[model samples]
Target: MDLDQSTTVESTQSGSSSSGYCRTNSEISGFSEHLTDDFNSCSSETSSPVSWPVTGRSPFRPTLSRFGAIRHDHKLEKDDKLNDQKPTDLELEMMKERFSKLLLGEDMSGSGKGVSTAVTVSNAITNLYVSVFGQHQRLEPLYSDKKRMWKREMTCLLSVCNYIVEFVPASQNLQNKPSMEMMISRLRSDIDINLPALIKLDALLIEILDSFQETEFWYDEQGSMSRNSLSGSFRGAPQPQRKEDKWWLPLPCVPAGGLSETTKKHLRQKRDSANQIHKAAMAINSSILSDMTIPHSYISSLPKSGRTSVGDTIYRSMISTSRFSAEYLLDCLDISSEHEALELADRIEASMYTWRQKACSNYPKSSWEIVKEKMEGDKNVVLAERAEILLFSLKQRFPELAQTTLDTSKIQYNKDVGQAILESYSRVLEGLAYNIVGWIEDVLFVEKSMTNQQES
Candidate 1:
C-alpha cells in the first residue's frame, strides 16, 4: 500500500487582481474579511493560507511581515526560476510544524464562529502524541533479521488503527458547525480504512515481543489502559498542574505471553550465537548507511527550490522516489505497458537470486563485510578457523570447484567463512535481499494489478 506517499498536499492560490487576492469566496475568505481597510497591498504567495496570521506583539510587526512576503512574491512572480521554487524537505517540515500548530488565531478570525481551518493544531499534536508516546505501536530498529526488518517496516506503514483511540469532546462552540461535521466524517473514514490495514500489516509481518509493544492491547480492560501518556519510551510529558505525574514514559506494562522452556532455550542459544558474531563484525560506524550520490545533472534539472540548501537536496530525493513519475523505473527497465512492468519486476526479482545481485564474498562491494574481518584475513583466529574448516569440507565435496572458480577471486569463490560463519552471514544477506525485493514488489504488483483491472 502506497506507504511512501505523503497525504498532505498544497498548491499556490492567487486572485485575478490585487484587490481580489485571497478575497475570493472560499474558506480562507474568513481571514480576508478581517484584513483592515488600512492595508496598502496584499501578499500573493501560494502558501498564504488562512491558517497563518502571524502574531504582532510589542517587538514584532505583522504589517512589515506582509510587505516582506509581498516583496518575496513579486520577485518570484517575475523570475521563472524563483517562482517555481518549492520549500526543501526541511523547510517544508518546518512550515508544516508552524502550520500544524493550528493556523488561525481568535484575534485574526475575529470570531471563532463559522470559520475554522479544516484541520487544527490539536489533531497534529494528538497524532504526534499517539504515534510516538501514546499506545501507538512502533517498529524495532532495522536489523539484518527478516523478522526484525519486517517489524520495523510494520511501523513504516502508519495506520490510524495502530493509535489508541482517545476521544476528545469538541468545544461547545463548534458542536453544530459544518467544519465539525466534516471532521466527524473524516474521522469515520480514517477509522474504516486505516484500522483494517494496520491489523493486517501487523499480522502478515513480524509480531512484536509483548514486552516491546505499546501500552495496552485492545483486549485489556478499560481501566487498565494508559491515559494521556507515552508508553515504552521511558519518558514523560508532564503537564503544568500534573508535573509530578509523568506517566507517559516508563509505560506501565503487564507481563505477557511466555515461552516454554525448550523453545526459550533454543532461542536463547541462537540469540547468543548471533550476538557474538555481530559484536565481532560490526564497527562503531556500521550504522551509517551508504549515501546516495545524486548527480549534478539531476540537481541542475530540478527547480531552484530543490538546489537552494542542504535540506532541499535531502528532500528532493525523498520527493522524487516517494511518488513514481513512471519515468525512472520504466526507463531503467525499458518498459511502457502494465504487462511489461509486471514482467520487468518479475525479471528483476529473479535476477536478484542470481550471482550478479547475490554475489559472494569475492564480488566487488560484497556483503561479506559481516564476517569479512574474521574470514578474509582470519583476524579473529578462532572465528577464521570455523570458516576455514567449512571451506575445506566444501572443497572436498567438489575438487573441481576448489581448483577453479570457488578458489579464485571470481564470483563463485568462497574464501571467507566456514559453515558457521557462512550460515550466519547468509542469514543477514538473505534478510536484506528479501526486504529490498519485497518493497519494490509491493509497488510493482500494485501498479500491475491496477492496470489489469483497467484492461478488463
Candidate 2:
C-alpha cells in the first residue's frame, strides 16, 4: 500500500480541510496570489507558466506553491510534444516501473537508497496537516479536549508506524523501532496546549523519521539446490539471505590490551577539548562568585547590635566566598566522592575562620590598615588592580588538576569524556523541554476545569 497517497485521500475525505475548523481558501489563495504576482513580474508571458532557469540567475525561481504544489514549468519542443502526444506501450510500462521504483526507494536519485522512505513518510504527515489546518492557525484548541486530542494523535502515529512496517524493509524497520518508540513516548508525555510544545513535538517526530531514513540494511545472497531435467540436483538462483536475530550491529570492539595508537591520539585531542571547556566553566563560576555581594535584605535582617563589628562582617563575606569556591571547584572537577569534597570545603572554611580571627585581633591596624592606606593614597586603584590580577591567575590555573585527571581517564579508558558531558547536557535540555510541556498542560487543565465548575 502507498501510505502517503492513502493518507492524502483520507485527510481530504474526512472534511478536515473542508470544514470550518480549517482555514478558508481565501487565506491560502491570498498567499499563492502574492507569489504568482511576484513570478509574473519576471516573465513577459504572464498567461503561460514561467519556467525558472535552474542553472542561471532568474527572478522566477522554482518554488512550491502555497497549496504544496511544485510550480516549475518545462518548455516543450515540437519533437517533445509529438513524443508526449502518444506514448508507446513499452514507454508506458517503463514509466510505471520507474514510478514503482521511486516509491519503493529503489531509485533514490541523488539521495542514498532507503533514506528517501523516511523523508517521504515525514513529508506525507506534514503535508496532511498543512492541507487540513493551513499555516499560522492556532493549535492550542486541539489539546483542549484531551480525549479527542489523544485519539487523533494516536491514529496519526499508528498509521505512520503501520505504513512503515508495510513498506519499509524489515531489517531497517526493526533497527529504527527503539528510537521511534522513544520519540513517541516523549511526545505523549510532553505535548501540551501551547505553540512551543507543539513545535517541539513536531521536531521530535521529524527526528524520528530521519533516524528511520538513515538506517541501511543489506541482505546476503544464498544458493538453493534444485532438480533440472538434463542434470542432477543443481544450484538454483541465489536468494537473499536474512540477517541474524540481532536488533543492531555490534559496536566496534577495542583490542584486548588497549586501543590503537591512533585512537589514543584522538582521545588525547578530545580530552584537551574537554579541558578547555572545563576551564571556561570554572572561569565563569569564579567571576560570578567574585562579583557576589551581600544582599541589602540580608544585611537588614542582621542584628543591629552586632552589625557594626568588622570581624563579623568580614567573616560572613569570607564564608560565602569559600563555600561558593568549594562548590565551583567540585563541579568543575566532576568529583563523585562527596566525602572528599566536603572535607575540602571544611578545610577552606577553617582557613578562612583562622584568617578572620587574626585580622580581627589587630583591629584597625591589621589588613584594614592596608586597605585604608590604599584607599587614601590611590582611591583603591591599587587594591582593584591587585584583585583583578589575582582573579586572572586563579581562573587560568583553577582547572589544571581536573584536566590532568580527565586526561588520565581518557588515556586509560579510550573514551571521550567530553563528548559524554556534551551528551548529558543535550539529555538535560530534552528533559527540561518535556517538564515544561507537562507543567503547562497541568496548569491549563486545572484552571480550565476549575473555571467550568465555577460557571456551572
Candidate 3:
C-alpha cells in the first residue's frame, strides 16, 4: 500500500458506480481503497507504544514523498483545530485596526526615529501579535460566509507574516543583528518583491488624496467663519458676515527701494549679515541645551511598535535626519502629547549615546566639535544642522567613518542666511503636515473593503 500504489476511481456520466484503478509504479490520481490501510499503518507505526526497528518496512510502507504529504495533512489538521477557536467581534476589529495601522505605516508605539534597539524591536513584535490575534477574532464573519473570502484573508495574512519576518530581526536584537541600515535595505527589496500590495495600498491612498485636493473648502473664502474663532464683531457674539467683503491683510512688503540692481545687491548684503547673526544665535541655543532626560511613561504611550509601514517610514526618516539628533525629529513627529514629546526626546538622546559608543568609537574629534560649534550658531544652524544630519546618516551607513563628523565650521553664520534656511525648513514641515492631514482624511473617510461587492 505504498504511495506509488495510488488508485484512481472514475465514474461514468450516468453516475454509475466509481471504479477504482491502482497505479503500480507511477504518479496517479484517483481514490485508492488502500488509502485507509496506508494511513493506519503509518499512523500506528509513528504513534506506536513501543519503538523498535522492524524487520522490514510494511507493504503499506511509507515513502519520503508520502511522508511529506502526511506532514501537510497534519498541518491542515492543526489549522482546522485552531480555526475552530473563533475570536469575538471586538477582537477582530482590534486586529483590523492594528493591521490597518501597520499598513498605513503609523508607529504603533513611538520610539522616535532611528534609535532602534532590541527592546524596541521586541515591543513591536508583541504589539503585532496582539493586533493580529484581535483581527483574527473579528474576521470570523469572513470565514463563516459560504463565498470564499478566506483566500483574500489568507493572502493578507501571508503578506503580514512576510512583513513580520522582515521586521523582527531589526525590531529584536535576537542575534547581535546589524544596524537598521541593512535591515531597511533588505526590507525595501522585500517590499518591492514580496509585499507589493502594501506599496499599492500606499499609492492608492495617495491617489485618493490627489483626487480630493481640488475640493474647495468653505474655510478658504474671505470672512469664512470656519477659519476664525467664534468671537463676533468687537469680540462679543457671532455676527452675520458676507464672505467676500472681509478685509484681508496684504502680503508682507519687501525691503524698500524698487527691483533695481542696487536693491538686489543691498538685499543680498543684508541677507549675508542676517545669516551671520542667525549662526551666532543657533550656537548660543545649541550650547544652552545639553542633557535630555526622557520619562518612561511618555515612551510607553507611543503607538506600540509593529511591522507597520509607518514604523519603517519613521525609522528611515529618522536615520536620514541623523544630523538633527533623534530628539529633534521626535519633536517634529508631534506625537499626541507634550509629555510624550519630552520622553521621546530623552529616549532618542540615550539611544544616540549608546549607538555612538557602540557604533562610533572615536569620541567627538576636534574637527567635529568645532564644526558642531559653528553649526550651533544661530545663523549657521541650518547648514550646521544639515551637515550634522548628513554626517550622522553617512556614519550610520558606513560605520567605519563614524569617527569623522563633517566640518562645517568654515561656513560662517549670518541672520539672512539663517532666515532663508528656517523658511525652507518651515515649508518642508508645512508640506508634511498637509500630506499627513490628507492621509488621515482618506483613511477615516474612504472605505477599505467594499460594503457589498458580490451584488453587482
Candidate 4:
C-alpha cells in the first residue's frame, strides 16, 4: 500500500509469456509522480495569469489573432518593397525644381506662388550666368592661348561685372516704396564714393589676367638680306610660344621698352591704383557678408523652443547672402551623427514594442488600452508618435502606470527620441545648404575656370 516502498506486481489471468515482464509498484508510482510534476509546471507557465505590477487584479489579456499578425507581416513586406525601389527621373526633376525655387528665396514648401519680383530678377540673372558659362565648349576658345586669352576673358569678366553692377541699382529699388527709394539713394551715394575704386579694380583685374607675356620675335622669311647687314638683318627667330605658362599668372606690371618716360610713369601709377582698389573691394565684400544676419521675419517665424522645419528656410537665405553664414549654421546644427540617430530610432522602436506588450497586459481594460488598440488598427500611425500618444493616455488614466512604464523602458530610449528629433532638423538644414552651395559654386567655377583655364 506504501507507494514509496518497492513491491513486485504479479500478472493475473495471463499466459506465462505475458507474465514474463513485471515492474515494482514503487517504481511505477515514482514515474507517475514525475510525469504529474512536469505537467503541472508546463500548465502553470502557459495557462497561469500574468500579475499587474501595481495592482493585484488579473486584468483581461488582449491576444493578437493569427490574421492580425499576418496582416502586420504583410505591411512590413510592403514597406521593404517600397524602400527597395530607386527614385525615378521624374522624382529627381521635381527635387531639382523645388531646390531651384528655394535658392530663389521661395519657402521650403516650394509653392513659388507669391515670391517677390526682385527675387525673380535675381533668379533670372543667376540662370543667365549658368546658361552662358556652364557649357565647357563655350569657354574652351577663351582659354586656347595662355598669354593672350586671359586679356579677352578678363574683358569679358569685366563686362559681366558691369552687368551685375547695373542690376544692383534695380535690385535695391525693388519694392518701390519711399523708404526703399531713400535706401537706394543712400546706396548710390556710397557707390559714388567707391566708383573710382571700382573702376580701378576693373582695370587691375584685366591687367592681372593679361599679365603673362613671353617675348617672341617673328623671322621675315621673305627678306632677301644678309645676316651681316645691320639695317636689314633677319629679325631674331620668333620666340616659341610658352605654352607652359598658366593663363591666370598674377604677374606684376612691367614697363614696356621703347615707351616714353611719361608713359612709363603713368603705367606705374595705374598699377599701384589697381592693387589698392583690389584690396579695398575684397575687404568691403568680406565685411558686408560677415556682418549679415537672418531677416527679422525669418527669425520671428522660428519656434521659440524645440526644433522646427523653418531652419531650412533660414539656411537657404544664409547661403544666398553669405557662404560663411551657411557654413556656420551647418556647424551649429551638428548633422554628422545622422546615421547614429537612425540606428537609435530603430532601437527605440524595438524597445517600444516590449514596453507596449508589458503595459498592455498591466492595463488591459483601461482607456489607455482602448486608445492603443484603436491605434494598432491604424496602419498609418508611426511608432514614435504612437508611443507618445499611449504615454499621454496612460498618464491621464493612471499616473502610477505611466511612471512604471518609464522606469521599465529606462532613459536610453527617451534620449534617443530627443536625438532623433534634432537629427531630423539638422538633415533639413544640410540638404538646403548643399543645394544652394552647389548652385553658387557652379556659377563661380565658370568664372574661375575662364581665368585659370590652363589648369582646367
Q: After best superposition, candidate 4 residue 356: deviation in angstroms? A: 45
Candidate 3 displacement at residue 196 in angstroms: 57
- How much lDDT does each candidate structure score? 0.26, 0.28, 0.27, 0.27
| Tens digit per residue, CA lDDT, model 3, 1-456 | 010112211110011001000001010111111112221211212232212243554322221111111111111224455445666675477558645443433444554432223222222332322222212211011122211122223233333222222222334234676634323312223222322322222222222222222221112222343325323211211222212322341111111111345433433333333223222222222221111122344333333222121345445554453454644554456566433433333333333333333222333444445544544543223333442343333323221110110011101111122222222221122222222332232222211111112122
Tell how far residue 399 is off in model 4, in angstroms.
Answer: 56
List, residue by residue over 30-144, the lDDT tens digit for candidate 1. Answer: 1112213211112222432212234643221112222111111122123334335554676456444434333442124445542223222212322322222123222221222
Q: Model 4 segments beyond 4 Å from truth?
A: 1-115, 124-187, 194-196, 213-279, 287-293, 301-456
lDDT of 2 by residue, 1-456 (tens): 112333332111112211211111001011111112222222223233212223443222222211111121212123234423554675456446534543764433745554244333333333334333232111122211222222233233223221111112122135645533211111111111121222223333222211212111111212322233224211221222212321121111122222345434433333333223222223322222222232344333333322132234333442342333423433455645423433333333233223333334435455644644545434223323332232232323331112112122222232222222222222222222222222223223333443344456
Task: Judge candidate 1 against the unseen true structure and give its global Cα lDDT, from 0 to 1.
Answer: 0.26
Backbone clashes for every candidate come to 7, 0, 46, 2
Task: Please provide, for model 4 over 323-424, each residue's C-alpha lDDT reduced to its tens digit, 9 standing for 90 to 100.
Answer: 234234434545444333233223333334444444455466665446566667332223324433333332222211111212212211222221222221
The order by descending TM-score is 4, 2, 3, 1
Top TM-score hit? 4
Q: Model 3 TM-score?
A: 0.18
TM-score of each: 0.16, 0.20, 0.18, 0.21
Model 1: clashing residue pairs?
51-103, 133-230, 230-248, 234-250, 235-249, 387-417, 387-418
